[model samples]
Target: MAGLPQSSTYVSLTTFRRTGEAVPTPVWAAPDGDRLVVWTRADSGKVKRLRHTARVTVAPCDVRGRTTDEPVEATAVLLEPHEWRQARAALARRYGWQWRVSYASSKLWQRVTRPGIQRHAMIRVRPA
Candidate 1:
């Protein structure tokens, strides 16, 4: 991994409130200092649930292929437009990851960029 970007591959833990249960999704993510950022559609359930609770947990995978279901406790918050841009760039640089659904897509660009539909939220997880 000589020329590859040196960064941790983290498993982002985000939760949501279901009708009568709790839901969680593990996403590949990038870390910036104490902040862990992830991008997703604003209409996503994760975004909706986060508004209700900002507490989150983030954990980096161990080199030995080991990971506990429970994550390190941390607080999370949303990112703004400008910050989102920076985070996106950082993510691309670190992991070469791209969003399959983008606000720039012709199919539903408007919906993706809408204030709260696909543009209302950004994930920012921090230390507890």
Candidate 2:
């Protein structure tokens, strides 16, 4: 799936379940050489699941008038701060203009309201 174009691509990450199987969440991701990177809230469910397992599935798709799902498995790693910054910069460049808010403002707000104020998680997924 990493070979596919970055646009219109979404990933579905799965973790173990005591019953049958867990439902997969849709994620936007981009490939960085052999690893794939995705951004999400640090305290998101996906991040919590990653602490339990490192395996996941990624799919590249086209929305067209409809949607398609092409699944592939990969082993994931949560990027350290430095790696997250680099990956984020790359993504922002590809996305063109950056988000208007400054990091300092975000930090200040996080110190207050505290919801979704945590750092973003960069999950690196290597093809399995």
User: Which numbered prediction scores highest in lDDT against the true structure?
Assistant: 2
All candidates' lDDT scores? 0.59, 0.63
Runs in model 1 deviating more than 4 A are 1-10, 16-22, 60-70, 97-120
TM-scores of the models, in the given order?
0.64, 0.69
Tens digit of lDDT per residue, candidate 1, span 1-128? 11111245656464646443545565656666656677666787878778788766555445442444445666668787777877776566656624433434522665555534434456777677
10-118 per-residue lDDT for model 2 (tens digits): 5555544434365466666666666667777788877877777777766654433122656667777788877777676655544444332444465677777776545
Judge candidate 2 at residue 79 and give its lDDT: 88
State model 1's lDDT. Answer: 0.59
Residue 51 in candidate 2, Cα distance off native in Å: 0.7
